[model samples]
Target: MKTLSLFIAVCIASTCYSQLKKLPIKKTADLHAFFHYTGKGERIISGHRGSYLKGYPENAIETFAYVLKNTPAFFEIDPRLTKDSVIVLLHDATLDRTTTGKGKLSDYTWEEVKQLRLKDRDGNITPYRIPTLQEAIDWARGKTVLNLDKKDVPMQMIADLLRKNKADHFMMVTVHNAKQAKFYFNDNPERMMSAFVKTEDALKEYEAAGIPWKNMIAYIGSENKPANKVMFDLLHARGVMCMISAAPVYDKLATVQERAAAYRDIFAQGADILESDLPVEVAEAMKQKH
Candidate 1:
């Protein structure tokens, strides 16, 4: 019985290690080139909320690490602050939905939040606990890029964390408009930032920001497929890559094949990045012929 138990333990440990594995991205250069429009039409994928499937809890380190290990994709995670002013990965203002805790996320101290287990998208409680921003940043070092969506934390705090971890190049912050992009660019000129450019006016706005185009990724929102070829061309002219988020349109499709075609269409429209909830599926689709 003792030997059997030891064998079981070993198997479990191996499985856990397999789940937390890293990808083949040896350095940040490959990821940087893919996002910065320098990779010669390399199509990139941003795993929405870190592939929050059945076993993978959203915004959890395990999910992010698993995606990094399995797929050639970066991830987007939401950052919130605790009552004690600690930055943590959480989507909503309250933890009642994603965690076992009650009330506002800010109501709990970091210690209290750490005790709460994360829930999968289907609402099943997982064994993972909330990870601090610094913990996530540390784990992403030289492995994968992270798009840090500014949810509840201040921009300055986020910038400081990126600088402290020396993760500016590997991580990104999403900016809604050119003004916000300018603000973040002014604060830390070297950091990577993503902004939306839906029209010619939007392009003008970004150009007016006075920041270098190399440091930004333009998110061109599309319907079922990528539109606005002129905007894409304009951005590419200035050495900027545009991302098309397929989550809003293609995620609701009934089959993977349909979604795959949609992704291919987006790329055909000159989108450099593909954002999706099904990162693994999309990455697989990208490899296959449309």
Candidate 2:
């Protein structure tokens, strides 16, 4: 048993390093052009879950339109795959967490899932059906940058869909391990994959893969996250640009005001692309305060 356990640990570590080697992270010029000016010149304010306010629906097309009109804010939506292979816009694995439907989503047909309504963060049912990824993309054709959130599904379809729709106006982000990043880039070398990073080690893994790490957005951990100075310092040294988030788990220090403050303090610390629930606040904070 002891020998077997030792062998398993070695296998796991080997698997990790091997996977990390597959990523095609870009270097110098290739990466810089992508992540260089995230939220800088563009006042693009993307709303979370389609601007989930106290009353608006989350992931609903209507809610997105409202956000686009009401504020300078753009909408951030999600794409998930159903058992039948249809891509839908949702934020949870189980519908029970954010919708009136019960049971695992994989167990239901696309039609059945569509009948269910989405709920707010507070559990109030809003009038939103699970929109297919294609439908959401079509709706926002020339209007906004569709932020695709891939929790765990491999991203081949997303690349295909983007090319099909000519929807090159949006930015995508995912939380990825080294192996996942490599596999994503390798599956289709022509496609772009964005990810979130919390540590210098993660950054190295992504950069090593030769993928364009600049346009690649990273999430700031809820706790003990590397400071922007530390983050930029490492990335700058590599000549790779980066984006920061107040996510991958929200923290008390992650208040909108604080993030905006961080945006101004170092200024450059505010990720090249600043993703926030309070897009307006961030814009005003960075534009007005700084």
Candidate 3:
């Protein structure tokens, strides 16, 4: 009996370690360096909404872990405020779609929110509960990066959360424009951002704001186009990596083969990173190239 128990414990520990792919980032500079463009065809995969799988719920820590188990990828998560002012990982203002609970997320306090279980994309209820942003941050430290997308939460509050946890090394914020980027930059000079620079005018806006290019990775657009080549060249010249989000476009394709082809084409067209809802599939598609 004793030998069996010891064997089970060892297996559990090994399984946990194998599931996590560590980023090895300990400081802000390390995070920046990881995202810096090197012109060596470095392709990265980012999980959009934590890579919602059949059994895993979107924006749940469990889903994030499942993706990391299959591939080395970071996550783009949404943060929203509760009625009692606690920050939580949720993609929508309403909980009906992603949780067992109904009504607005802000209508419930953290205590009430924690009681509800998460639902997968197919509406199948899972045992996983909603995770606090702080809980997710704690889990991501040294394990993976969490890119917080702009939601209903105020920018100052998000910045304060980062300051409170001292999580500048692994946390990144999504900024829609130069002003938002500048705000985070001024708060912490080492802060890394995923900025929207899909156009030449937007590129000029960041240049005018005077934020260092080393501090950002530009999101060129949803689809790969002839125009993206121009932005890729321009941003790559500044040592900033370029990303393309396929969540809106190719992830909705009719078949797995079609999505896989789209994933391959994105990198073939000069995108440094591809953000997708099916990160595991994306990893599988690009396995040979990497």
Q: Among these predicted structures, which one has the highest lDDT?
A: 3
Model 1: lDDT of residue 259: 82
lDDT of 1 by residue, 54-96 (tens): 8778888878766765676788888999999999999889998
Q: Measured by TM-score, how close is model 2 to the native structure?
A: 0.69
Q: Give the lDDT of residue 92 in candidate 3.
A: 88
lDDT of 3 at 93: 94
Candidate 2 residue lDDT tens string, 181-267:
676556544334446666788887877877765445455443333355677566555544454443332312457667666544433
- Each model's TM-score? 0.88, 0.69, 0.95
Q: Candidate 3: give the clashing pairs.
A: none
What RMSD does each model have against the real structure? 3.1, 16.5, 2.0
For model 3, the local distance difference test gives 0.92
Alpha carbon lDDT of each predicted model: 0.79, 0.58, 0.92
On the 0 to 100 scale, the lDDT of residue 231 in model 3 is 92
Candidates 1 and 3 compared by lDDT, better number: 3
Q: TM-score of the candidate numbered 1?
A: 0.88
Clashing pairs in 1: none
Task: Kindly list the per-residue Cα lDDT of model 3 for residues 1-290, writing each as its tens digit.
Answer: 99999988986644475558777688887998899999988989999999887899999888888888888899999999999999999998999999999999999999999999999989999988999999999888888999999999999999999999999899999999999999999998889999999999999999999999999999988988878899999999999999999999899999988999899999999999999999999999997553
Residue 43, candidate 1: alpha-carbon lDDT: 82
Per-residue error for 140 in candidate 2, Å, reads: 2.3
